[model samples]
Target: MKLTSALLLIFIAVHALIADGTVEGKLSVDLMKPSPSRPGYLPSPTKHPVLKPESAPAIVYLERDDGQYPRLKTNETAQIRQSGYQFHPSMVAIQTGAKVNFPNLDDEFHNVFSCSKAKHFDLGRFRKEEISSDVLFNKPGVVKIYCEIHQHMRCFVVVLDTPWFVKTDPEGKFSMKNIPAGDYWLRIFQPSERRIQERVTVMEGQTNTLNFTR
Candidate 1:
């Protein structure tokens, strides 16, 4: 009986190990420019430089076909600070129905607005040390953030349905660990609505290296 129990324990351990997996890849990104128009909010810049992946890394994630996942109900907030006439973290990706906290760290005022299909909101004139009410994203889509005070101030809020997401490094490398061995679709969104998706499989105790270019 002792020997049988030990064998059973070993089998369970190996099965658990085999059920764990990972996904890693180097993302070949093509980032786009932030929105350049905020009529009546600020002047249109004469020039706008397209962003590189190093400056604005891409957000890579695994998606569920059902378009639903267990999301947290807590009041935790993601911040987008206004400082030095720019929005820190020019790109953000979060689960659907998350609240984005916009805080103005600069001495001046900023009018934050977005016309994106995901969510449309305008936080009028956030002054120094001031913050707006939670900007809730109930849908899954890319939200373009801009400042009416500074036409050049631009950023993004990518709302997703799943929590399995990460931003690529400056060198365009990314990894996702502890994924239950299964089939999945790897995806990324950058610049604006542009995105890339691929089918992949995760295996136990193994690293899956998947690469993409676009």
Candidate 2:
């Protein structure tokens, strides 16, 4: 009887795990330019002096704004450094209500502000090693972050309603686990890369993979 009960418990646990799904994929940017002659061989620009124009491509995911995924909350902390007169990690993604730490790591004081419709606030000038302020993204949208003294300094903060969202890594890879099985719309974005979207269905104990190129 004891052995039978143990087996039953194991089966129930397995079934519960199956109720959750997962997603994994890679995102990458491709610049369309003239190809060099042979492999690892290119005409010397100094010698040819041919003018080349480059373009930036990007992709953004499309999602519904209805308040869903209540249990998919994630608490995170982020930083915007005042080095090189600019913000490092030009693009960042955070969940709603997550705290963002603005630390001045430079010799000069810095001011951070965002006038985007989604979020609007400003942190007055702050010195090195000091945290200017912390912000909680109450809504989901894109926020353009900038410095008051530096016009060239700019960064992007993507506030998401679901903690399941993640930015692609250096290799453009992203994954989310333990998602309740359901149908969802998946999208990808690159600041200068082409945007792509598709329908995704999450099944029990399965992984979905998507590869996008610009």
Candidate 3:
């Protein structure tokens, strides 16, 4: 997205003027209950899998109001396809005013709908490879989506106001750069877990670190 790139350049220019700093942090979840946002507790595939259950990725962002952020409004669309009887990305974080395409890629019919507080709508059943409709996320919050016929099929669309965000790696680590010098509330959003936040002041050229454990 050219707009997104432009905004990054714009932020860089401003950061160069101010003493802006970078924000690098990590989020740690309980090993006993790796994911708490889903329906119920399910044992990890293997007891000693290559990656620990707590290393699951999560969305990390800054909750602050800069002059203007471009990701809030985008022509690029997000997709949540029902392929192999599951949502491609079970969870996603997008800015407000963005549109998400819910395409049915499976042979069986699927009806996608959400009853989350952020927004609500029902897209009647649609055929394979057919996109029932594009849902506009104008409100900011967590929107839970599901299939009427297939109750097991679910997706989470996280609508946000700030454009400065990135999904954590499997190690639960994330980084943010070119942020304006200021104090902000760093927020972390993980599936099946409550959001975690911490206050931190950013300084130019320096990398700040914040960590969560327990």
Candidate 4:
């Protein structure tokens, strides 16, 4: 009876261990170069809050792009808002097959679409308070979303293959849970910007924090 009870307890523990995992990380900007595409090199808080007269734009606004579980059902929802003639939360990460909702908060009508490789669709000029559309990301990659009428308006939809993922906050902090203990290939996508990649491991009942630069 003692041996049987011990075996049952071990089985339960193993099941719990296999049921969840987690990954936490920090992403920081290592400004290397000023935005060459834009001129004047303006020094404004809205654009560039902290100006380094001698600081090259090699790194700035460093953030973490963490995806927790690699192999899992990816049925999720994400929000992309239209405001200030731009898409708020410019960079978004969602799992493949996940649906994304575009909410128009502007007074005037606006059209949103993505011609990028990962996903493509046109949510034609929608009116404020009447904004609604859904797009299922069938591919996993960096998708550039833009406004048809406003050439300067742009954003990014990062279609990921895994369901477990989270974008770091402005402070570059991210936390993910329910990941079965294992290894994963982590990646980050900054909208209309660049993608960063790294590898991580999630052990049973353990949380790990990572950092990314550039």
Per lDDT, the best of the predicted structures is 1
After TM-score superposition, the amount by which residue 116's alpha carbon in candidate 1 deviates from its true location, in angstroms, is 1.1
- lDDT (tens digit, per residue) of candidate 3 on 1-214: 9999999999977758566578997877422233234454453232222222222357888976463555534575789877766676777788888889988776677789998999998999898887467889899998988877666567678888888788777777889887777778898877765788888888877889888875
TM-score of each: 0.80, 0.73, 0.76, 0.68
The alpha-carbon lDDT assigned to residue 51 of candidate 1 equals 30
Relative to the true structure, candidate 3 has a C-alpha RMSD (angstroms) of 7.4
lDDT per residue (tens digit) for residues 1-214 in model 4: 9999999999987887666667777776333222224344432222212212221111111122444334455457788887766677666776677888888777767788888877778989887879466788878777777776555566667666676667666566777776666667666554325557677777877887777755
Q: Which portions of model 4 show Cα errors greater than 4 Å?
A: 1-14, 17-19, 29-75
The reply for model 1, stretches above 4 Å from the true place, is: 1-18, 34-54, 72-74
Which candidate model has the greater TM-score, 1 or 2? 1
- 1-214: candidate 2 lDDT, tens digit per residue: 9999999999987886888777887767554223313444443222222223323233234354454766344566777565756576666777778778888766666789999998998998887897466888888777888777554466777777765676666566777777767787786656542346788888889988887654
User: Comparing candidate 1 with candidate 3, which one achieves the higher TM-score?
Assistant: 1
C-alpha RMSD values across all candidates: 5.5, 10.1, 7.4, 8.2
Candidate 2 ranges with C-alpha deviation above 4 Å: 1-16, 30-66, 71-75, 193-195
Sort by TM-score, best first.
1, 3, 2, 4
- Give each model's whole-structure lDDT: 0.79, 0.67, 0.74, 0.64
